[model samples]
Target: MTHRVLAAMIKHETNGFNRTPTTLRDFRDQNFHLGEAIPRVYRGTNLEMGGFLAAAEREGWELIPAVAASATSSGPSTDEAFEALCMPLTNTIRAAGRLDGVLLGLHGSMVTASHDDAEGEILRRVRELVGSDIPVVVTLDPHSNVTPEMAARATAIVAFRTSPHTDQAETAERAAAILARTLRGEVRPRVVLARRPMLTGFDGARTHHAHGPMPDALRRARALEAEDPGVLCVSIHSGFSRSDCRAVGPSVAVTGDGEDPRFRSIAESFMDECWARRGETTERVLSVAEGIAAAREWRPGEKPVVLGDYGDAPGGGAYGDGTAILSALIEAGIPGAVVANIWDPAVAAQAVAAGAGATIRVSLGGKHDPEHGGGPVEGTARVVAVSEGSFVFKGRYGTGTRGHYGPSAALEIGGVTAIVTTKNKGIYDLEQLRIFGIEPTAQSVLAVKCMHGHRAEYEPISSRCLDVDSGGITSGDPLLFPWQRVVRPIWPLDPVEGGTP
Candidate 1:
């Protein structure tokens, strides 16, 4: 029998420490697509309709597209905005009677003004509307803080394995397929969550070789998946503790048979491994100054120096407007440099007003959190080029996806060209610059405001790259921030407990 399925995608990863509160306006600023707008804006990559369509075609199930809304990482979403986003989906589900299954794409770290567990709240509402027996599957970013509520509500859940998250579509397909199988009575879905005290240490937790203990744990989990005939997938969620929610920490989830002790044990074992490798994971990192110094003198032909601007990382709930690195480069007189996407909507508007080739005095960077990034760099820059902000993915990360910078321009300030945008998108595609008349390959130094995801794309083009410990909300150092809600004795915060307090 063909079943009817409902699907929607609404995602946002919030950093509680950010000064600016995320609102519906911020979503507009970031170029978020509501239900119908997704197809027109984002085409292929992680398209909400694509997942539902793929499942419907493959399983002969009727599909309904309700809503799809996503905003870039920021502070807790206002209560009004959260409800505004979720209402459309809940209303559709209510009207649909009963659904055979449901699929949702969630970031898993959304902190709303009224709710800390935004995903869980949505799940609870959806479960109430659809009832508990209907299979619900979810696709999440690896950075998710998987709450108990989420595990209890979602029958089958999968997380993108890579940090750059190029596999979003693949992960969504897997979740949808799993839901279809469960609905067809071909498989029963089960889940168990294992918690670790320490926050998943700074970046690279997604890296294959540098992942340290994660690779081994994943290997063992895969073995368990093979051994247990019922086990379909095992996921290690390196939780996003920057969210400052109650359910924040690393987690292990195994999905297959209902409430299997073996599955729970397998997940627990992986959590133990994560706890064991806490010492090797370094959280506090070097500053941009330190990273620049290292890169300036880096061996002529060494590994591409990846300069990860943790402070301004768009993926990590930052404003992505920090100018510390750009200012430093100017001061040091670093020649042959490229900086992708300084979020200066105001400046972008000014440039559009002035037109290309016109020299103008513009304020760039530090618009959102002036105190953190040192409040705007004022300068007269030549607007060499302008675009409506369209670029193709040429980098290793997001290779197949299309990126829109949303009214972008290249502002040349001496030897360096700063790619400015009205939208806040981290540098994951090389075309982000090339499309705006700035090619990164020819540059001696490139600065990217990203957490770890930038490595996948920039590493291929960079002669050398280094992660800068720029001081901001998403810093590598966990101890630098005062986390009150996180479980006690997690890593460098309380080393005596070995991060298990």
Candidate 2:
């Protein structure tokens, strides 16, 4: 008999320091597809929704798609946006005559205005409607803050082992397979979690680092599953520390065959490793001046030096309206440099109005909070190109996915071209530049507003990549933000002995 399943994607990575409140419109600006539109938008994409769709076809399950809504990282999500994401699933669960299993795609770090542990809240509601007997398996981002509530509610949980998250679809497939096996009575998986009192760890979950903590942890996790028949899946969440929630730190969840004492032991061991390697970090974030000097040193004939605006990473809930690096480039007169992008809808509008080749003086970026990534830079620029700012992803990070930056314009100032956008989203794919007629290989410097995800695509084309501390909400240093919500005595926040205190 074919099993009936309910599937949905509700995801967010809240950055507590950001002032912007995420709303439904924000989800629409990034990814929002309800009912049938879910398949239309994400049937073959590289997201969790795509994996669920594939599972339905492969397993002969009656897949019920409810809603897939994910807003870019920002301050706490509004109650309304949270409701919009949960209601579709709840409404569908209420109406669906029966559901054999539930497959969810969640970013384990959602902090809404009403609830700090938002994904836990989503699972709580799901359990409320479905009860505990039915199987519920979830796939989470590697950066999720895996709470006890999430581990308790979920029958099985899996997270991307890869940091650039190149394995999003693969991670969901693993969760779906576990659900399938449980429904078939092949296994009875139960999840157990263990976390340490730390703000961050696991080398920021960078799988690209061959000797990083994540690679070592993931190797051990995979070995556990291979050696032990009781272990179904092991998920290691490095946690989103930018989200000032109590559970905002590294955790490990083991989905075992049954209620085995060994599952908790496995999770505890993993957490111990995380705590032991709390101080190990692979990337070094340099100051704005250092990034500018690197850009200035680049020659015209060499591969572009990718200057990363680490602090103002949009993917980590930064406002993305930073002018620190842009200002530096202008000050140093670094010719043949490109900044893609600086989020400023107002200046983008002005560029769109002025049209290509029209010179206009405008203040760009740092509109959200001048105290963070520097105030706006006032300058005259020639509009080189203007676009609707929508494109398809060709990078390994988000292959087969569609992305939009809203109205965007290529403005040339002091020989440096800036891609100004109406909406803020991290730039990971080279298609972002190709859309504006800027080839990634041709530029002397490609300063991007991104965190680590860009390493997947940009690193190959870049001669060298340097992390820049522009002082936005996504700064690598956790001490940069004012902390009030996260549990006290956490690592880097207060002095804590090893492991759970």
Candidate 3:
């Protein structure tokens, strides 16, 4: 019998400390394709949906595309936005007569205004709609906070092993393949999850294998799967620390046959390794002044120095309007320094109105909150260039998608060049600078507002990279934000006992 499977994707990583609530407009602005439209747009992209289509075609399974929606990482989603995004998928499932299995692409750290465990709640709803007999498999970001509810409801869970997440399509294909085997009665998969008492960022979770502890732990997990016949897949979720939910922190999940006696121990050992390396994962950051001083001393013939403004990472729910680093670079008189960028719509509009080659004085960035970063820097700037804020990504991650910065402008203020945008975007590619006529490879210093995600794209070209704690909502130090929801006794926040949660 030919099997029919339903597939959908609804992904968002929420920052609980962000004051602005993500709305339905945000999803619309990103990409919200429903029904047949989903495949038409996403089938060829490097996204998870592309993999689902490939597996369905290869396995001769009937694939039903439901809803595929995603928004930029931001604050908790509004109730209306959550319902709007989920209803299309749920409604589609209700209309379908029968199905052999289900596949999903989810960011495990989603939080809504009304729900803390958003991904778990989504799985529960799908489980209710499909019933228990059908096998459900999901592909999640490694930074997901693996919840018990997610483990109980879904038959299997697989996460992208790479931190910069270049293997999204591969992970999705694996999930689809596993579901196919389960439907064929070749295996009965079950998920075993374990959590560690740690709340750490991705600074040390680099999957380069030679560089960090994350790869070694993943290697051990892969070894466990190879040794046990029942073991299906092993995943280490480092967890997104920006979220202040109860399930916030690192976790390990083992998916295999229920009869496997080794699943629990294997999962525990993975979590234990993560717990042991807690100190390495903790981020050490430099002040903006210190970062600029180092950049200024770079000798000629050296590779470009990349400065990461951790606090202003829009990918971590920062407002993207922080001006501290920009101010410091300008004050230091660093020539050929390109900041790409600061999200300030007002300044972008002013630059557009002034036109290229025109000089104007404007207040740039820091319009969100002064307490997060410093207040705006008022300066006289020459409008070097302006764009409609649309370009295709040349980075390994999201390689083919067209990204928008809304109305944007390149402003030359003294010795530093700043790219100002109406829309907030975390830089993960050199094209973001190239589009504005700035050549990143030739620059002396490239100041980007991002964290680990930028490493994949910039590190190859950078002689050295520094993480600057410019003090914004997404600050490397989690203690900077007041926490009320996350579970207690998590590492660095509170002491753990006996190397366990």
Candidate 4:
């Protein structure tokens, strides 16, 4: 029996605080890979689409292709635009008649003009169209807000466990395989989620290195999974609290059936551990000086130390224009370095105009909000390489997902090289540089704008990495931002003295 499975990707992570609404232009500006334009291999890596195709091939199923639309992180999507995006897919699903299963790639943290729980809304509508019999499995970003509506509406949800989300394709493969297993009656899928009260700041929730409580919880999950046969998947979702929603904060979810009490017990155990470890997570980050010093002192090793500048990640709806870290690096005169994805198109154009090897004075970064990091700094730079930013990768998770760097170029100021792109990407892959003739392995210092996932690839080559204290929309200091509705009473925000509420 050759079953038919429909697959599509619609993703947008909305930072409600950001004034810039996610529009069609924003999507086009930030490397919108729509329909067939999506890369066969994105930035030297294969993408989730490859995983779906692989799974379908194994199952002897016919995979129906629909539109896959992904925009960079931005403010809330306009209601009209979101509806327009959803209707086409929804209408397609409605008209498709009976389908065996559906697969969707979604960023779980999307908050649009129409709904706070955009993924949930999508799933709920899809559920209405597909009914109870047809199963729907979704692959999500680890930072997604796991709402009850989403949990109830979808049959199974698999997400990238890593924060920088290096495991996008791996998680997609897991979801697709799981969906196939469910459809084949090999395993009955069930989801039991345990909720925690405390809310964590973005920086404190990283799963890599000696990161927040999530890593320890993941260890516990591994142990529990070994003991319980019914536990198919254990997801420790450190909820994206930036979008003020009811299902905020960290949660533990177990997907399986046959043992309700056991599932609840395990879920609660992990949830309790998350709450216990919340006090250890802090927002008092190291200064840029501290970061530079730490990076210099790190000894050469098998795994490079990864410094995550979560504060200035453009993926979190940041302007990606901060100059604080660059200034610090320039002052330190660190050699053999590359700080990627500075997001200065004008500077890129100026460099392009100057032609390769030509020396030109260009303004770099700080165009979005100069007040945060003192805006752009003018410097004499040489164009090192100009590229279309093409590469293929079987990602760190080993899922063979293709990624992209769009139209990218590299600029050198002093000894440091900076990658300027027309697109805003949060994750840093080797292909991003390798495609442009810049090899990261040759560099002593690698500064990238990402929260955590950088550890998978960049960590292997780094001498030392430090989460540089920088300023942008995703600043690690949660206290700096004023929130009207975040379900607070945690960390520096509450000032309870006990650390986390």
Best candidate according to TM-score: 2
TM-score of candidate 1 versus the correct structure, residues matched by position? 0.91
Model 1, C-alpha of 15: deviation from truth (Å): 1.1
Question: In the order shown, what is each candidate's alpha-carbon RMSD?
Answer: 2.8, 1.1, 1.7, 3.8
lDDT of 1 by residue, 98-215 (tens): 6788889888899999998999999999998888889889888778899889998999878877666766777778888788778868888977887866666323355535445656
In model 1, the runs with Cα more than 4 Å from the true position are 28-43, 46-49, 201-204, 208-211, 282-285, 298-306, 392-403, 487-489, 495-500
Query: How much does candidate 2 score in TM-score?
Result: 0.98
Give per-residue CA lDDT, model 2, range 1-501, as digits (tens). 879999999989999888889998999778888888888888877889999999888999999998898888999999998998889999999999888999999999999999999999999999999999999899999899999999999999999988688888888889999999999999999999999888888877878777778999999989988999889999998888999988899889999998989888889988888888788877778999888877777887889999988999999999999888888888888778899899999999999999999999998888888888899888899999999999999888868888888888999987789999988989889999998999988999999988888888998898898889999889887767899899988888888976755
C-alpha lDDT score of every prediction, in listed order: 0.76, 0.89, 0.85, 0.70
Q: What is the lDDT ranking, best to worst?
A: 2, 3, 1, 4
lDDT of 3 by residue, 397-471 (tens): 866666789889999987689999988899887888888888888988999988767877887899888889899
Ranking by TM-score: 2, 3, 1, 4
Best lDDT among the predictions, by candidate number: 2
User: What's each prediction's TM-score?
Assistant: 0.91, 0.98, 0.96, 0.86
Instruction: Output the worst ten-in-a-row residue range by lDDT, candidate 3.
Output: 201-210
TM-score of decoy 4: 0.86
True lDDT of residue 195, candidate 1: 82
Model 4 lDDT at residue 428: 60
Q: Which stretches of candidate 3 lie over 4 Å from their true place?
A: 201-204, 282-284
Q: How far is candidate 2 from the true structure (C-alpha RMSD, Å)?
A: 1.1
